[model samples]
Target: MPGPTDHGRVLVVDDEPQLLRALRINLRARGFQVATEATGAEALKAAARSAFDVIVLDLGLPDLDGLEVLAGLRGWTAVPVIVLSARTDSSDKVAALDAGADDYVTKPFGMEEFVARLRAAIRRGAASASPEPAIVKAGDVTIDLAGKRVTRAGEPVRLTPTEWGILDLLARNPGRLVGQRELLTSVWGPAYVGQSNYLRVYLASLRRKLEEDPSDPRHLLTEPGMGYRFEPS
Candidate 1:
């Protein structure tokens, strides 16, 4: 029986029977609903059919490669996945992370540490599960996307049409990367797709109006050479 706080539903994917049984017993004893799959195909099917709080996946699978399964999962779901593997090489860890794994735990790990990691991953997933609210509050600033309004410290912040467009797009997709070219083409016309300077200028103006410190933005983030991500605190 699970208590109020014991709401974690975990999916463990591994080909090794002994490891699966051990994890199932330990996790279930700790009041986690545990589901196990022996093959990557089975794991994919199980994940598609159910809603899991977190996933513990083995890199070495009998049918499909673990990375392939990870790619498949990332295609439709944003579920948190932790990679469990015997490969100790840094390249393997990097590959797994690049393929969308939330965390990587080398094999022969301590049960206590693994459980702690599982808890942390579940916490992160839960935090990012919900979309941004209608009125997004970040530090001293608040953005009302639906109302097309921005305020800071109880005062309305004035913004141009272009600035509002950029802020609105970013606010709608919190914690997800919005590419530069995508932003330009969407906000401006397709002819302005390569005009990266437009973003730099508009973003600076946006920060000045909405951020407490224009030079160091908190909610508005830039992934150098890649894109921007809006993080709501």
Candidate 2:
């Protein structure tokens, strides 16, 4: 409903008083409704009670492990959780991600980087892929534009906002080869159209998730020096 830049709620869960204060001040300054909790139990309760746009979670807690809190939250909520902790080991990061953290930020992080990551996570969490009500069919992939859903060969497919936006744009212009410029502009906005690397990376991910053979894609066809096309089967 509202744009991402508008006011939204954020829950900062950490035992450290200094970090909690800093996050509260910074996030409030950036136009977010901030809530702070000092324990895993309180974090879980807060999650259950209120709708939080993004969660800045610390790995170590006094009562319960942060991983437990992450798992608990993921059980019922897809609320974007960003793990912020001093644990920089690969294992710790992987564990948090595996437990369903949307993003991970290590401690001693730059405020700019932290804010950027937070913005991206929040944008992704709240972004609606579909612009208006319409059903788009491209091969086995059926995108219910209004419903904001995608299904492949009768099986539902879960897509992030960015992935769904890309698919929706391509489906809207079936049979026409949507150039890199148009697709990028349509999905990520004009400011990002020149970032070819972004297109390449996301296309690869989409193909991997949707195509029968990512190497030899059936529906998502890449036009070298051009862009991509969605050919319905």
Candidate 3:
């Protein structure tokens, strides 16, 4: 069993089977929960389902390009990522860094240096993990993100697990439009990306409970055929 001082969760994305196995063992031995993916698509999908403390991504992937995967990750979460690739050119390093990678390491690197860099990257991530207020108020709804509770007009309101999931994600990104696919991937898993009906029904229920007028909501809003946004007035 991992102790309280266990490092953290990690997702490693690379195509080399031997490299993946080595990393899984090495990381786990150092008190980290490790998950590995060989393809960029699966890596992005894994990220959607889990909250990782740090990610180790390779530039060369079998399915989608690594840069594409990086972009996909940046679209939603701000998780720290360290890139690993055999590409030794300074340009490759620069490109990865410019694409939101926290750190980049060339292939065939020593374990000591890699581990040191990983720790340093994680420290930076944690240091910059600024605190956000747990209580959010918008119109008549008071969303307690930490407690997973909601209230309207000073009275408690009940929400199903699915309803709360949708509201929680949208509320966190106040003023930003969350795409329908992203919402589904985050709350309902990657398999539910095409299930827009689930969102429509849940969103309607949420508006009825939280919005002053469900017919013409002021906070919980839809962007036609696009997605949803949460505006805190």
Candidate 4:
């Protein structure tokens, strides 16, 4: 097998063989170096052993709660993780994202959509590390979206890639009400315009990184149901 390269390396974790096989095939077809594991323990071991560009994690693992796995991964890794769950409840979705899952997909999803979401998650993650111009800022926080570096009060602040993507998009269009559809489309691509959960997760993360009070955000302002506007003060 070819080694992991600039393209990407992905780990697909699911208890079911068929689902794993399907994901492996699709990810490989999309030019990702693929790795698979059927158990949460195996997934942890694989993650500990290598640096994967992304992880597609199924929420219903046989040995552990998917949230636990996500939390564990969050403890040490910054790898982008997209959750796959059969559950449709908004609470479940919120929990996983709050716990550090970068994105989520319900079961019975189209392959094209799945591929698109995976690509979005990976792209959002990769953007921080990619080369670009200088850093931008609102106040004390300096955000180098291209370099994935954030510093506030002259100290470094870490942001997840998803969070950085949100900040990057808003910074590019300062003081504009980046429509929900427009943000989802611009950040994650056209297929994700309706996936508001992705927006919620990333916005929360961005506020936590750049705001003095995330609950009462200043720079990352919510435009109610419409979308978000980044007002740099």
Candidate 5:
């Protein structure tokens, strides 16, 4: 039985029987609720069925590639996923991250390091948790953070994947300034920290979609050279 502050539910997706068993036992002993799935299809189905705190996924799966599974998961859920794979290629790691994985761990990783990474991911998730009014209303725009949805003027508003990523990050903090570097790295990965232009373009698009006046935005406020803030009023 885990204490109140114990790590939350974790889903482990891998085809290796021995590895799955090892992870299950270790994670359970460490106070994480563990669920295991051996195939990518099964993993996707399991994820759709249950809510998980974090997902530990193997890149090599008998049914589907791990990146494919990651894409499927990202289609609906924003649960943090840490990819565990034997592929040591930098491209493989980049692909997984682009597909929305939170972190990547190479094979033969130490349990201590892996657990530490898991804790870090869980901690970030906890820190980003919404304070109250899970559904935030800003002007005519309604943001349902838990449901990963945004609507404007009583109708659903469509946002690009990148747009949603940025909005979600800002909405999580609610009226707080989310710095440019933090927003870039968190949404587009660390390699994109220097790409401030990307933020400008996407933010423009978001305003057009969500704000009544795109020229002088109300909800999505830019703090000159500092960062962006979401005003949920």
Candidate 6:
């Protein structure tokens, strides 16, 4: 039951009973509504039913791998997710973040740091959460925003995950200038917002795949010294 004192809703997914209990108690005491699930499958079902302010996820699950869960959630929602995992490998952390987790915390973390990270994720989720179009049409390319599929000239066009992320943001706001800074931050993360070269490379790849003329793009337009635009005419 949500109360007047509740700060926001939190969904915590971990297989450990003790850990789940601790997180629920701590989060609820901090004025956040809390839901706990032991498996990734249940977590996905709960997420589908109710919107949450943030999600704390553990990479180890009995039914579904945490990375798979992240992919499933990103297919529909932009809710902030903090991965709570026992795995300390740097590669594992990078994979989770790339798969859509907002943050990753290894096991035996301090409660203070966990809460602080969750707060940051909540802030980010608020700014990013919104509805996306089902489909967008460009000159000879078609973007199925909801399905995460794309086609060019009536043929399917395979795109890498990074390419899809860049294109998805632009297609969501057709004819609107999606600034370079926003694209860099949203797709790559805040740290890489200064890396304009990353955007150039991915955008070039997107253009090559979806544009009839890669050199003279009709749909994907670059605004000099500004950003890129998707002219969905």
TM-score list, all predictions: 0.65, 0.59, 0.55, 0.60, 0.59, 0.59
lDDT of each: 0.85, 0.80, 0.84, 0.79, 0.85, 0.83
- Better model by lDDT: candidate 2 vs candidate 5: 5
Clashing pairs in 1: none
Per-residue lDDT of model 1, residues 1-233, tens digit only: 12476859999999999999999999989889999999999999999999999999999999999999998998789788999999999878766765667789999999999999998888778766766568988887889987998888889998999999998888876776666765787799769867888899888888878877878889898877656778888
Clashes of each: 0, 2, 0, 0, 0, 0
User: What TM-score does prediction 5 earn?
Assistant: 0.59
| Model 4 lDDT per residue over 94-204, tens place | 667656677779998999888888777777667644654466778887877667677899898877666667778788656545567657766788788679888898888
Using lDDT as the measure, name the better of candidate 4 and candidate 5: 5
Q: Native-vs-model 4 lDDT?
A: 0.79
Worst 10 residues of 3 by lDDT: 124-133
lDDT of 6 by residue, 1-233 (tens): 23468778999999999998998889889988899999999999999999899999999999999999988998888788899999998778756765667778999999989999988778666655545568888877788988999987888999889999998898876655566666887898879966889988888888888877899998899976567878887
lDDT of 5 by residue, 1-233 (tens): 12475678899999999999999899888888999999999999999998888899999999899989997997788788899999999778756765667788999999989999998777755655535567889998999988888888889988878998999988877765666766898899879977889999999999999988999998999976656889987
Off by over 4 Å in 4: 1-6, 130-135, 138-218, 222-233
Worst lDDT run of 10 residues, candidate 6, spans: 124-133
Off by over 4 Å in 3: 1-4, 132-233
Of the candidates numbered 4 and 6, which has the greater TM-score value? 4
Report how far off residue 116 is in candidate 5 (Å): 0.8
Q: What does candidate 3's lDDT look like per residue over 1-233, in tens digits? A: 12477787889999999999999999889888999999999999999998888899999998888888998998888888999999988767655654567778988988879888887767656654657569989977899999999988889999999898999998786765666766888898979877889889999999888888899999999976557889998
Q: After superposition, how far is residue 222 of candidate 4 from its true place, in Å?
A: 4.1
Q: 231, model 5: CA deviation in Å?
A: 18
